[model samples]
Target: MLRKPTLLLAFGIFLIGACANLIWVEPKIYMPGSTEIEVEGHGINGPVDILPRGTTAITISHEITNAGNSPVPAGYQITETVIQWVFQRNIASVGWREGDPATHTIVQLSQSGPALDPGESAVISFGPFTVGSCGLFGETLELDSTNIVVESSNQDNEDKHLFFVPSNQIINITANTINGTLYHKDGRTLTHQFRINSGGAGNQWLYTGFSWIATEGSTADAVPAPTGRVPQGPAPQLINMFVTPKDHDHSPLGFGPSVKGKVTAISTDGCVVKQKAVEVLVEHD
Candidate 1:
């Protein structure tokens, strides 16, 4: 027979051995980082419609989710996650507007706050803030392009499914200077421009005649003078077009309350092809 203390000791040893076996058999997974994150839109661009306005606030939110099969391990942690906007060119050479997002700072979230459990998600809010200058540069002194980026312990967060979509997509044809006011007094002479552009994109041609529509009087009476060609732009990207003043195209308020200018153009088939209307507003001042 065993003494009472001896019996108790033997039972305790059995319990310890059984517990050890149970714990070891259980699977301990060590995937310390997030596996997947959620962004609302497709491509590298956060939202297809988001454009950086000089003063208007724009919001970009990304959901960081733990997509692993198991919880983050005890010893390992995600130190930080970085969010930023980047401007890039097709070629490797750095661009004039390329680098970090100027108006906004790169966001860094510390993982020290809490351990991420598998399947749990956190939404990272970037901005309800506006951006500053677009950093545009062209022969006509216009345009800028930028895209979004998110960085973390995982590279897939920022680079996954990259289409490099632009926040703002400009129309192939753009007008720069109307020169004079939309609303102008009668009998005043003014000068203005319609810019034809192609940075080696293609050959673009206008539909010859540009005309204005007057609300009050006949189109003929509204435009006392006809359209004429105007030359403009910097070297290499220089574009020339048929431009005119509002007074010449649509006289003034006697013709009506307002006037609108309209013309059309078609690009050469081979390069960057498009057929679109070119328009501008000239008011009575």
Candidate 2:
């Protein structure tokens, strides 16, 4: 007969072995709808440049992983991704403080072009464009995704999945003038001398001429229709000045327009723009 202590020891070993095997065994394959989606990335926060009637480019990227075991279904697709700038006062749990709500606006930065794959990732780029009306100083950037789907080769295995992944980083962009010039069509000449100043909310002050068409008067009256002014005609009032950092540096003058502005100033905490505030929007071509 086996000793009592020996039998107990054997039982203990058996239980441990059973536990180990259970841990190694694969669990039931979860239906796509049954599993959760995961997204990981650094959030965008802080000051972003807002140029009136101008464009700017910004790059956003992140990694998406399939936390669940098993292939996330053969026909799984990632439909859409978007980034928006939000102005809120609550402190983020991820260790970032939201910006003040009084003087800010949320703008959608970019939308994804194509669907993503299971356990796959991508980087999205959007263009240079004006940041419409609202000011965006001390704002917070939020990344989100939508319309995720999971399908399989089998006719009956189609499943729909949808979710969002938010980040904890803020976007900070500064406005700086790259180059400016004035052009005169009538004189057939260009002048590089022009003074530019931040016109608040990304608008700049420059000199330009305005023209209007002359109306016909009663022929019976004095003066012959005032000479040069055509009757209800269209004339070009050339506003010679131009500004930029356009992608290409080509111009009839052998160079592009000039821009005059200061670089974006960062605060000590690096969460807001110093001495400047403006709203921004992301335009994609």
Q: lDDT of all the models against the reference? A: 0.30, 0.25
Give all TM-scores, in the order shown: 0.27, 0.22
Residue 111, model 1: Cα distance from true site in angstroms? 7.6
Cα RMSD for candidates in order: 20.6, 22.6
Superposed Cα RMSD, model 1: 20.6
Q: Which stretches of candidate 1 lie over 4 Å from their true place?
A: 1-56, 73-97, 100-115, 136-153, 157-285
Candidate 2 residues 141-240, lDDT tens each? 2222222333222222221222111122122333232212222222212212222232233321111111111111101111111111111112211122
Taking all chains together, the TM-score of candidate 1 against the true structure is 0.27
Local error of candidate 2 at residue 235 (angstroms): 53
Model 2 Cα RMSD, 1 decimal? 22.6
Tens-digit lDDT track of model 1 for 6-36? 9999999665433100001111111121112
lDDT of 2: 0.25
Model 2 ranges with Cα > 4 A deviation: 1-56, 70-103, 109-118, 128-144, 150-285
Error of 2 at 85 (Å): 8.6
Model 1: worst 10 consecutive residues (lDDT sum):
138-147
